[model samples]
Target: MFKQKKQQELREICKSRGVSLTPQRQAVMRALAARRDHPTADQLYEDLCRQMPGMSRTTVYRVLETFEKLGLVRKVDSRASKAHYDADTTLHPHLVCLNCGKVVDYQDREFGHLEPPVFTDDGFQIVDYAVTLVGFCRQCRQDPNN
Candidate 1:
């Protein structure tokens, strides 16, 4: 969807969730959707501030957490300490670059078919999962010059 439509939908989502749709929240979503870097709250705050010179870091982090809680975005933690937000909310997996830490979504039937073994064995609820394939991207794998 276009930014205007997506922004309107995001506003509606926030309203439904009882979150006040302040311009800071709107700008956070816009900054995320505008790029594919999987930026953190700090990165978002920097960008948001460039446009909205008065935006706060705390608000950016809070809005992103709110978005995740509403299922408007996916939160992936490729490691223990950091969380990455994904805009595409669908059945998919991740191809993560170990060198630069870029995450790209990879969707396939093979991945879709793998049910959580624990669900059947121990009767645990399986909501969703990200089947990760970690490796270096082409740019990271290639030498700068021949």
Candidate 2:
């Protein structure tokens, strides 16, 4: 969860984007930001429903998509059947557990040793690329190995 100051800053961002700080949207953002577990839209909605009564599952899903476009959040890649919401904006790779399907962050000096590959675009610009590293988390390696 972000500090009060960061929450206020997020609110300001919404205002500047001309996006209303509706109760539903606010609740959804708060829930996602409060958690680092990288929850799916449905999971997020379940949490929001408890805090903000009458919150629609669809609203939670749509609001998240809007915030993603506004750069307030990101979709964390996972082996799970659904997408996950991530508030961290730092550039880093992820290690996905095959057994429990957990997502772990990874940053290595080796990654910095090589320059990123580049390709010319016909017209559109390429801003950036995310490097996702897939592997088993320590928790998944315990006991019987899969």
In model 2, what lDDT does residue 42 have?
87
In model 1, pairs of residues that clash are none
Q: How do the residues 1-146 of candidate 1 rate in per-residue lDDT, one tens digit apiece?
A: 65576687788887788888888777888888886656667777888888988888888888899888888777765552567776666657777877777777665646745666546566786777766778878888895332
CA displacement after TM-score superposition, residue 111 of candidate 1 (Å) = 4.6
For candidate 2, give the lDDT: 0.74
lDDT, candidate 2, at 135: 68
* Winning candidate number (TM-score): 1
lDDT to native, each model: 0.74, 0.74
- lDDT measured at residue 93 in model 1 versus the true structure, 0 to 100: 73
- When summed lDDT is taken over every stretch of 10 residues in candidate 1, the lowest stretch is 109-118
RMSD of each: 3.1, 3.1
